[model samples]
Target: MNEELAELAASGATALVSAMGTDLWQEAKGLMIRVLGRARGSRHNELTVALDRASTAARGAVDARAVDYWTEALSRLLDRDPDLAQDVMALASLRIPERPGNVVQLISATDSAEAFAVQYGSQHFASGPKSRERGERP
Candidate 1:
């Protein structure tokens, strides 16, 4: 499997899972079904039932493995239709909403040295009630 394609599957799966029972659920499900193409027909009812169950489970308390289950399902679909990788990725990207306005970030390190540090996506950092000086360590 293509690494990038696999990554897209994983990401798209998470988005689909998160959007379950939301306004985006139908849209995501449609896109996912289309991506599945002919294979979808064979598993149409099965998939629908699974998605509904997932949505119901999500609506309740919490299911930590929901994302993983959805990711695996999406991955299997991708594996079945390697040709739809790009289209699936495009659909996945569409599910991700863009953030408007300026984004701010604050990063702090204390008594630690590291190489190749990287961060992605929206994040926030707020100082606690008690402020502490960051001292450098030799």
Candidate 2:
């Protein structure tokens, strides 16, 4: 399963790189593909940490203009890839702070319909901590 997911991530990365024509994106995608492979095979916390590092690396590779471009591209990509959309939405949910018990309330109060939809949709597709620990393939 881990191998499969790594392949999927790699394929996504490759597609992204081909579409974007940026070395940074290519490097980041390669690292992420490897990280996902390792995580799948071992289900280690260290692997998860590495994946996070890869994500950070990928983020760092983006300039302001690139960010805008990527955002637009991703929006269009999501329209074509429901799975990617779900993964992205789930990641956004994870980014939300769950502190002070008010976090839930705060999330509930958000006025943006898009935000709410993304959050709700993410739950359906986001990989759980336990599954991650077990290296269960998405």
Candidate 3:
């Protein structure tokens, strides 16, 4: 499989798993069903139920392996149904919950000096533990 397609699969799976039990659950579930249905053809209903089960598992807490499972599923689906892959990509792009431009979170920590920094897409983030700061009692 192409690396890009693999990335899409991984991203879609993560989004699907994270959306479980959130306000976006229904939308995310529906999008997965639709995309996987296109790939599964006559097996659409079966895939739908499986996706639901996975979502239910994710509702309690999402583990990294869950993302891998769904990612592999999507990758195989795309491999077998190359034509449907475009649709999957498009749906994933639009409805997988958080696209590139979405602001998923904004975290801010203030101190006299910065210890760590993360910068992405015009956003800057920094953090430092109080325990590591100077002149602080343990």
Q: What is the lDDT of candidate 1?
A: 0.64
TM-score top scorer = 3
Candidate 3: what lDDT?
Answer: 0.69
Candidate 3 wrong stretches, greater than 4 Å: 41-46, 58-60, 94-138
Candidate 2's residue-wise lDDT over 1-138, tens digit each? Answer: 244344443344334333233444444454434434433323335544644554545432224444443344344444444356435432222222222332242444223222233433344636533423343344
TM-scores vs. true structure, each candidate: 0.54, 0.25, 0.58
Q: Name the better of 1 and 3 by TM-score.
A: 3
**How much is the lDDT of residue 8 in candidate 2?**
44
lDDT of 2 at 38: 31
Q: Sort the predicted structures by TM-score, highest score first.
A: 3, 1, 2
Superposition error at 92 for model 3 (Å) = 3.5
- Full-model lDDT for every candidate: 0.64, 0.39, 0.69
lDDT of 3 at 133: 54
Q: Sort the candidates on lDDT, descending order.
A: 3, 1, 2
